[model samples]
Target: MHVLLISQYFLPETGGTTNRVASLAKGLQSKGHDVVVITAKPSHPEGVIWEGYQDDGLVRDEQEGIPTVHTWVYADFEKTLFTRLCSYLSFMCSSVLGAVRERGSFDVILAFSPPLFVGLAGWITARLLNAEFVFDVRDLWPDLAVAMNELNGPVKIGLARWLEHFLYHRADAITAATDGFCESITSITGPDTPVQRVMNGTEPEVFRRDEAGKKLRKEGGFDDRFVVTYAGNIGICQGLDHILEAADRLAEDRSGVLFRFVGSGPVKDDLQREAKRRGLDNVEFHPRVSLDEAAAHMAAADALLVPLADHEIYRSFIPSKLFDSMAAGRPVLLSVDGEARSILEDAEAGRYYPAEDGQELASNIRWMLDHPEACTEMGENGRNYARTHCTREAQAERMTAFLEELIG
Candidate 1:
């Protein structure tokens, strides 16, 4: 099968969407499928073109034998409404043009979303090429933006909502990354639309527990501390203020607890300011690290933190960090509600607190700190569970089977 994948973010961009799409592409290639990824130059979270890469409209590269096509997009790391819109629109135009110029016969076109405009491009290309187009809904788009108050003006929000509907209805098959998203899309687009819940998973080899990482942690002053690390985007969706509050509550327990936030996003500045204002000496902030570095950090931590804002849209969402933490044999400290919490409890991977409940989160943190042995046990359980359920091999097999059915 010849597959064309369209996404704004890709390899070297340290986000869930990038990792998932890369893994899927590689997996498909390994299974004898010819996969071509059409993506923008590496720029996300910190929306700047990666060093050594030029934004010259389009460039083609090969990673692990998969052909990847990168296109130029206007993006700056600044987190303003106007800039984000420009970034999305730029990618939409560039990707459509790039896809058209490439002109390769494809069995199917898969478009991943957040900036749902990519789906629009896939729809247009599929129409032109007479190929099946699958829209991979990673998040419920404009509705999620609306929920976060990111789309402030009423008119803009309305237009975005309309576009969102248009994309959903136009797709051949919709693949949602979460069950909640699948249900929501089904409700909105009707049961007739093919929607499958293909979750975000980790590549086991890349994210397993590492003794070297543990040694690095000890050398880096993490020997005595019970580290609770949040190793992903620090965006608005992640209500990190609650984590700061938890740090404040555990400040007096100097010997036992430490909070490490090892990522960057729009909320990083505000989180740092809040931590300083609260005099959270227990908390430490680190810049976003590469995939290997992040894996090492996760392996070193006693527990991983997954915090989501108290919003209806987030209930169905499971942050990819949770899966990485589980793969690293690190117990999770989840402050997310809904389907995500359900997954943790079913696996017995970690303890959960209500979203935005600082006191409850602090109490859970203290409990984990006191019960080191229990934490270790939970970590082991999580690793075992992840090996079976959330590994790349498992997810890829499922995705390949879905594609095969579509092609047949």
Candidate 2:
């Protein structure tokens, strides 16, 4: 099968969306399919074009064996609604143009979403190519925007809904990354529309302990601390203020517990300001690192922190960083409710703290710090669970098979 995948973010810009698309492309190639990934020229989270992707033409490259085509997009820090919308629009326009350039070569087209405009590109490309259009729901778009209060008012919400439904109704198949997403998409597309829950996968090899990582941790002064690390987007959705509050409260009670935030996003400055205002010396902040570096930090930590805002809609969402933490054998201190919480509980991988509750989070930090043996056991459990059920290769194979069946 020839597959066309549209993702706004891809390799050279590491994160869940990039990782997932890259993994699937590799898996499809391994299974004897010609997969073409159309993405923006490697600028994300930070908004600076990555090295070598600065060429103004439609830059193309091959990773492992999969062919990737890159195109133009507005690469800027999405600090405001105007900037974000321009970035999204630019990517959407460029992705569609790139996909159209090689339109008729694919049997089926799949588009991942967040900047939902990629789905529009997929729809257009599929139509031109006379191919099946597959909408891969990484997160329910404008809904997440609305949930974060990022998109308000009837005019904006209605427009978002209209576009969302447009893609939902036109898709040949919808593959959701979560069961909750599957349910949500199903609610709109109705019972007849095909929706599959193809959850995110973890890379176990990268997350394991390593000597270089150990050296790096010692260099970072993490060797003496019982670190609780959060290594991902420092955004509004993360609700990181809770982590800061927890750090403030546990300053004296659990002086050994250090909250290390190792990532960057729009909310990062605000978070740092709040942390300073509260005079929280136990909290440390680091700029976002490469995927390997993130895993190393997680492996060095005694526990990993995953938090989501206290919004009801977020319950359906599970950030990909959690799987990385679990694979690293770091006991999780989860501040989430819903599918993510259920997964943690079922795996018995970590302890949960009530979301946005600083006191509960502080208590859990103390518990983990005090119960070293128990945390170690939980880490082992998490490693086993991740290895058994979430290996990227295995899940990628499943996704490929699903796509094959859908195309057939």
lDDT, candidate 1, 287-383, per-residue tens: 9898888888888888888888888778889878788888888789897788888888888989999889889988987788678898889988888
Q: Clash pairs of candidate 1?
A: none
Candidate 1 lDDT (Cα, 0 to 1): 0.84
How much does each candidate deviate from the true structure in C-alpha RMSD?
Answer: 1.4, 1.4
| Highest lDDT against the true fold, candidate | 2
- In candidate 2 the C-alpha lDDT for residue 341 amounts to 93
Estimated TM-score for each candidate: 0.96, 0.97
Backbone clash tally (model 1) = 0
Model 2: ten consecutive residues of lowest lDDT: 209-218
Error of 2 at 121 (Å): 0.6
